[model samples]
Target: MNNRKYIMLDGKVIDKSITETEFVKADKNYLYDSFGKRYLDLRSGLWNTSLGYSDEIYFSVSKEFSRLMNKKLAYLDIHSFDCKLYDELSTNIISFVRNNMKKCIFTNSGSENTELALKIASAIYGKKLNVLAINNSYHGSFFGGMSVSGIDIDVNGRMGKAYEKVKFIDFPDDIISEESMLTWLEINLEQYDLFFIEPVLASAGVRIVSDNFVNEVLRLCKEKNTLTVFDEVATGFYRTGKPLFADRLKYKPDIICLSKGINNGISPFGSVCVSEGVLVRLEGKPIYHYSTQNGNLLSVSSANSVIKYYLKNGSLLEEKVGKIETQVKKVMKLYPNIVYRCVGAMLAIEVEKQDIMRLNTILKDLGILTYFYNQPTNGLTILPQFNINLDVLEKALRIILNKIS
Candidate 1:
């Protein structure tokens, strides 16, 4: 009975009044609606807009892209004609993250990259193997990703469960002691062909994985010849005020999946970085894992610019994020009734009677936009641009506290 005049979403024509938040334009730090009402973007476009809406990098990349197109020097696809920029960007990314990764394969999104990482692991092992993923973790939206995700997804009253080979284990929690968890992992580690982890567990209320757990997992996986894939899709590219959350660990992961902040939310881009051993294993094999726009010039140019920006100014961003973290800590101290977790540029705020959807709407009405996480905990994650105005953010935090407290 419902027919939308123009747009069709989710296979149905939904009512227009369902959501009021509309964005017509955006600039550094804020999005402006049609009525010219500006809302500070706190989720950073799902934690990808690390460089904000507008920046010199964007302008420069656009100009470069235009010039390349005009000269017919820009090939849209990586497979068309090997572009040197592809390898250049990949090298720089590997260098920038400072991880001992060997090479990267470009993809269009985090989901694609994560799925691709899984494929790579399967291909290298040359068999169908079990996948071990932490409970409450989110890899991506693809079928392979959905299968391993900790949060149960249901479609038409049927649970969209993980693959038969996928197994879920509890993250180190109050009920599951770290020692017991380690013991369990030690006993059952070898059964898995791949072990997936989100360094910060961004979707799981910004839950940070402890060093001991990560180190133990890495050691066990290494001993078992299982590939440890770090799904840094959300925690990568300085979102955690560090180039990568994996860097803080005692050992390196076998593979690292990256996206989001690489292009500062300008282009659809992602890269799956693997260690030297993986690259060698698949060197001569026929690997069927590439899309037409896998290494499109638009994404490559934007990634190049973003990588360059971070290389030149990572320290400044770290300093700014440190200050913001301090301010948030102060706010948390003032409101002892609420719960909060902050690491680098990501912060989560929750209350006893948490209704994240309602709180999200309240924030939108208050001219502050954010995204909420559901599962294990209901909370709002404050993921602002690295260059967001400190005063504006401080005020917004107080406003959020006023509602929750």
Candidate 2:
């Protein structure tokens, strides 16, 4: 495919932009420029390119679904074989998912899953839409997700004081002390309808909640009649060393969000796994929250495949990621001034820099993708896929260390 207006116009982007080695063809896991240099994808290109490019199996499933989907939306639902595929995928996924979370509602993106979850929580629970979120969390750029998100100063106005309905909590970097959560709950947790969390806060820099603190939060929330919601958009799939972060944490959120990995089936698939209890509350409701492109045959087919691959052969990936974490710790020791975190395969290394741009420019050219010092981390992250090879990861880390040093 030709470039998306990026090639014809050279030197156009001026915002410390991300330019590929070439402006030419877009392929799976591989981007080729007019010059023909191949860049190994380190960041999964927006962190969603699992199963990599040139995944023929994924395309095959899409083609099979398209033969059935090249019709009207109405026909695509009732008369389409896609429904059976959806049922089968969802059914197969449940055994892999938590037992309390037994139902799923499909959506277009993780943000949609967040929105739908919040909406359902309020509709099913009550009009009080107050949700508690840790500071510096990244749910999404959209409003509902943004509203509950701890990302401060959202320029898009996706979040505002309009979302005062939401509450903010300090995510504990250490074991969330019972003393801390109980203290927090005493000051807050009132009229709080739901507690939303990323078991391992990724965007805030791979900070894992202390097991004791996490269990205490659940206990306190249940004691206080607060519902728990896990936003696993980034951590889902095999990214977190498990299919979902909650899987490792073993907590059944009233609503468990899924995206980014759902449709490694083809492209762009996301959804939510609603608990049986949440579903019970949502029954008999006249909520029309479905999206047309949602549950698309192509994406669902790919999502099913990704899930199968993980459930069947992802243990090896987990072992590799565990090693990557260990290696990262050893490397971080060389940079004592750098504050860092690595948990469940998500990682961040924060450096107090006088000029951040210099650091980013050096790393970007090295084929390592990362965000700037956004929030609390003041450092970016290394969020590779579960199946990402160890050598590929080590090369990136070493390159980063060399540049920083």
Alpha-carbon deviation at 272 in model 2, angstroms: 1.0
Q: When superposed on Cα atoms, how far off is each prediction in RMSD?
A: 2.5, 4.4
lDDT of 1 by residue, 42-149 (tens): 989878888897758678888878977888865566776777788889878988876779888889899898778877877887877688988888888677787778
Candidates in order, TM-scores: namely 0.93, 0.84
**Model 2 residue-pair collision total:** 5
Candidate 1 residue pairs that clash: none
Per-residue alpha-carbon lDDT of model 2 for 41-66, expressed as tens digits?
55555567644564554565656566
TM-score of 1: 0.93
- Candidate 2 lDDT: 0.67
